[model samples]
Structures are given as C-alpha cells and as structure tokens.
Target: MSDEPLVRTVRPGVRVGVDVGSARVGVAASDPTATFAHPVRTLARDEQHGTDLTELVTLVEELAAVEVVVGLPLLLSGQEGEAARIARDYAVALAARVGTVTVRLVDERLTTVDAHRRLRDSGVPGRGQRKVVDQAAAVLILQTALDTEARSGKPPGEPVTTGGRRKKERRR
Candidate 1:
C-alpha cells in the first residue's frame, strides 16, 4: 500500500486462465496482445480419467500461451480452504503436463459470485448460468491478472512451480 503506484512490465503474449471447480473447469484466453480475456470453454471435471487435464494441456499448447493463470479461491479471511487446496492440486498436475508454459495462482475470492451477478445483470438466466458461470468467472480471473500485471508491474499471482503451491498468505 504505497501512495506511488508500481509500473509493471508485462510481456505481450497470449495467456490462458483456468477456474477449477468441483464439477466443472472453466477456461479463458487473452488476446495475443494480452489486452482482453474471453471465455474459451468449460470442461467437465474428470478426475477419474484425467480427461480434463488432458484437454486443458492440449488447449494451452494449441493456444501457445505464454502463461497459464489459475484462479485460487481464498476465503474472505485470507485463508486457504478445501477449494483452494483443490485448485493447487489442479495447478500442480497442470504444471507437470504443460511443458514449458508457466502456471500461476491468483486470489479469486468472489469471482464466481461476481460472475453470476454479471451474468444476471446481462440477462443470462439462473438455469442457463450453470453452464457458463465458471467461464464467466474465468474471464474475470484472467482480466484481473492482466490488469494487475499492467498496474503493479509484477505478475498477478505466485507462480506454480513443479515443487508445489507457492504461498500461504497471498492477501497480506
């Protein structure tokens, strides 16, 4: 919290955003200029068969993304919970499979809730939202990352190295 804002130097390239949920995985991608993010797709969580991760890895490769930003849902108290743990695991698995592309986790406290609100505000119905809420949330997550990197002159979140989860107190 400084009076002077940090000027971040962000690389210009395509970045992918992921929102990992218990039932579905949302995917989003930024433009090559790293300007805007839009929904890519939603994959059914297939932990049993590992299909979700497979598809995600393929998608990232296809997009030739420079970075992959995964949403880490932290509790309002700035603490980790089951959902956070799940996201971390997903990121670890993704990192192992994604080759050189980097995976970073950004705090996503209420992106899903906000996405729902945005969808509703945009006239998307409750029932219809179930199919795309995750994607909307992914968009918010990626846009937030892009904005953070541009404003703070730093990557938006902690990078997920093959070693494992990066930090515990991200908010502080």
Candidate 2:
C-alpha cells in the first residue's frame, strides 16, 4: 500500500456511470464532451452474472464510452462499509469485463436519498419511484462525478485498479 492518492487525468469523452444493486443495475451515459449524464436504462440482474456483464459491455460499445464510473457507497464517516465492499466487488468484476475502458469508483453518499427527493419533487409516487429510482441515482452519481472533475481539474474518485482490490482495500 502506498500513501499517495492515485489521481488520473479528467479527459473529455463519453463516460458511463453504473449503480449496481442486487436486483437491478442502473446505467447512465455522458455525451462525447462529457458534459452531462443522462439515465440510460435499468437492467434486471439475471442469475447468471455473465449475462449481465455482457449486456454492460454491449452498452459500453454502443455508447462509445471511454470511461466507466461505478458508485461506491461509502459510509457517512468516509469509511468503507459492507455496501462499499459489495460495490467494490461489483466494480472489480465490471473492470475485468470492460477491456481498455477506464473503470472508476466514486463515493456515492446521498445519491439515493437525493434521487428519492427528486422523484418526490417531480410528483412521482412511491410505486412509480421504485421503477426508476436506481436510474435517477445513477444520474446523480455520474453528474456529481462529472461536476467534481470539472471543478477540481482532477478525475473524480479513485481509479479502479485491475488487480481486483479497491482503493481503500489497497491501502490495507
């Protein structure tokens, strides 16, 4: 483990953001210039993980994504929790499948809450929210990442190394 933070250049290109869940995965994509993130779709997870991964690859190819950003659900204290571990595992699995495209994990603290709020503000009821909340959360996560990179001039979040260990775990 190293003390230095791994930082990457924030480049302009199509980027995809993923919010992984046990039941569903939400996907969002940015434009070529990487200005905005829009909700793409939510895919139901099949019993075979390979099938879901293949769909992700196909989506990446169709969108011409240069980067794949996955939401890392860190605790409020900025510590890795159980959900974080699950997210990291999913990200590692995703990274292995996406050849060449950069895979990143960004902290997603209140994205889901914000998504719920947004849906409520838009007058979407609870039942309606269930169908699209994940997608909305994905949008929030990707948009935050894009804005962070734009403001800081550094890539948002930590890059997911190909070694199957997440940034925090690598420190251990």
Candidate 3:
C-alpha cells in the first residue's frame, strides 16, 4: 500500500469529526451536503487499545463517513506541542484502524473552549457537561473544517498518513 496520506476530494458528503481525549472521545457528523455538523455521541476510551480503535472503526462504518477529521490541538502560536503530538499519534492510529478512510488533522486551538462556552450558555451545568463536552467540541472541529474548505476550495488541514511516518515527510 502507498505510504502517502490520502487526500480526499473537497466535496459535499458525510464527514465525521473526532475530538480525542484521555478518557472520552467526542464524535460529530456532517450532513450529506457537508453544510453543518452535529454532535453524534461521546464514546468512552477503552483501556485496551484494540477495543478503543475497534469502537471508532465501527462508528465510521456505521456512519459511512467519506472522511474523518481528527482535531489537532496546536498551541496558540501555531506550534505543535505535546498535546499536538498526542493528537497526531491518535490520528495515525485512527487512520490505520479504519483502513481506506481518509483521516485529516485539522488545527483545533480553541474548539474545546468554544464547546465549554456553548454548553454554559445553553444552561448545561458544568457538572453535567462532561457527559457531552467532547461531542460539542467535535461539532466545532468539523464545522470549522467544513467552513474552511468551503472558503478555500481545498480541504482543511493535513491528512494523516498511515504507518509510522509523519505528515510532513515525502516518500522517496
């Protein structure tokens, strides 16, 4: 198989957004036209790696998602810090988990903050937000990516390559 990351065409179709966290993963999906993203559900992270990935793969299959967008949490100054590294690792694992499906890592600096604010404004108590915060963040991540692609005529962010290579490396 080619080691290069898959570059999916920027078109209208169902897309899934993922916000990976230590304990929970938030999932969101876009409409067939890719106009809006809505929260799907929050999934618990299994302690075993295989089980976690399996759940994600099952979700992908069930959604028939054309592309999977994984949020990359970069620093405010655009640097890839430790959190970014973890996100990248998750993206690579996720890409490998769901073979043939495109996984893109979009910059998601303030999506979590936005999610929290939205939940607060909507009267979701801080105590109860944990159950759905990840889903809310996933929605923001996907919506931002969809909007970016629509405005630029290009897919937002970089695709996550399978195997162990980084996205910046070119296959020789």
Candidate 4:
C-alpha cells in the first residue's frame, strides 16, 4: 500500500475550480496565494470527450494551478445521479492526467441559480451572460470549497490544515 498523502502540500500558489456541464466547461482559478478566484473562460464542448479533457488539462496547467476542485452536480435531494457519476469519472481521469496536482469533488447545488443571479445583478446581457454562466458557477464552487476548508480547519482534499496565515472566513 502506498502512503502518499491524499492532499498535496498547500504551496503558495494558485488553485483551480471547474464547473463541467454536458455542453460547456467552465474554469475559475485562484491567485497564487489562493486568496481570490478569478473567472477564467468557458470552453465549448468538442466533438470528442478526450479532446475536451485534453483541452481542460492544458488550461489548468497553463494557469500553473496546484490543485483543482470540480463541482459535482448532485440532485436537489443531495443524491448522486447520472450527472454526479459522470463528474466523478471525469474528476478521476483528470486527477490521473494532471499527475502532480490534487483534485477534489465539491457538492454543487444551486450553483447555477446563484450564477444566474450574479450575472443579472451585474447587468450582463442575457445572451452574453449565457457564455459565462458556467464559469461563474465554477467560481462559486471554488469559493465554497476554499471557505469550507478554512472553516473546517482542514486543508483542501485531505481535511487537514497546516499552520499558516488564516484568512477571514467567508461563505458562498
């Protein structure tokens, strides 16, 4: 049995969040210090799943992300379904492909609604907003994971935090 750590050491670097949908893949990445999540871009689905995954892996690597948190689409009843299963499979595949980074699956409930609300409140045109809703949802998912890790006294992935500068806790 291998004794490798579940969560990689929290380096002073960027982390990423992803909102994966059937048609679109959204990306959000944090600053190197893991202090802020910035909406990256939404990639439209390619004809092949492998191509899409490759593109996503390239994007994450391009950002120099240390960790990745993928939003798991759970049903309103908090149960896993086909969508959740697919997400889990994708996450595992991504983790393997990335090799050096940590990946996490975070419950994604009401994230779409929240994203829509945010866009509307920000006065984004409906048509233009559609292109980025997934990205916004990804930001929400990443922010929530970061907050949960902070509040639970846990580092992302392994549920433990090393001694370091703690930031003000916030919820999404």
Best-performing candidate as measured by lDDT:
1
Give Cα distance to truth, residue 63, candidate 1, Å.
Answer: 0.5
52 in model 1: Cα distance from truth in Å?
0.4
Clashing pairs in 4: 13-32, 155-160
Better of 3 and 4 by lDDT: 3
Residue-wise lDDT of candidate 1 within 74-157, one digit each (tens)?
A: 999999999999998999899888877778999999999999999999999999999999999999999999999988777788
How close to the true structure is residue 171 of candidate 4, measured as C-alpha lDDT?
26
Each candidate structure's TM-score, on Cα atoms with residue i matched to residue i, is 0.90, 0.87, 0.87, 0.80
**Cα lDDT of model 4 by residue, 1-172, tens digit:** 7697445233456778988888888889988767678899888866465777788889878987767888888999989899888777777777767756667788888898899999999999889888999999999998887766655556554211112322222221
lDDT of 4: 0.76
- The segments of candidate 4 whose C-alpha lies over 4 angstroms from its true place after superposition are 1-11, 47-49, 156-172
> lDDT per residue, candidate 3, 21-138, as tens digits?
8888899999988889999988888747557667888988998877889999999999999889988888888887776678899999989999999999999999999999999999
Candidate 2, overall lDDT?
Answer: 0.84
Candidate 1: TM-score?
Answer: 0.90
lDDT of 1: 0.91
Judging by TM-score, tell me the better candidate of 1 and 2.
1
Off by over 4 Å in 3: 1-10, 164-172
- Per-candidate clash tally: 1, 0, 0, 2
Residue 84, candidate 4: alpha-carbon lDDT: 84
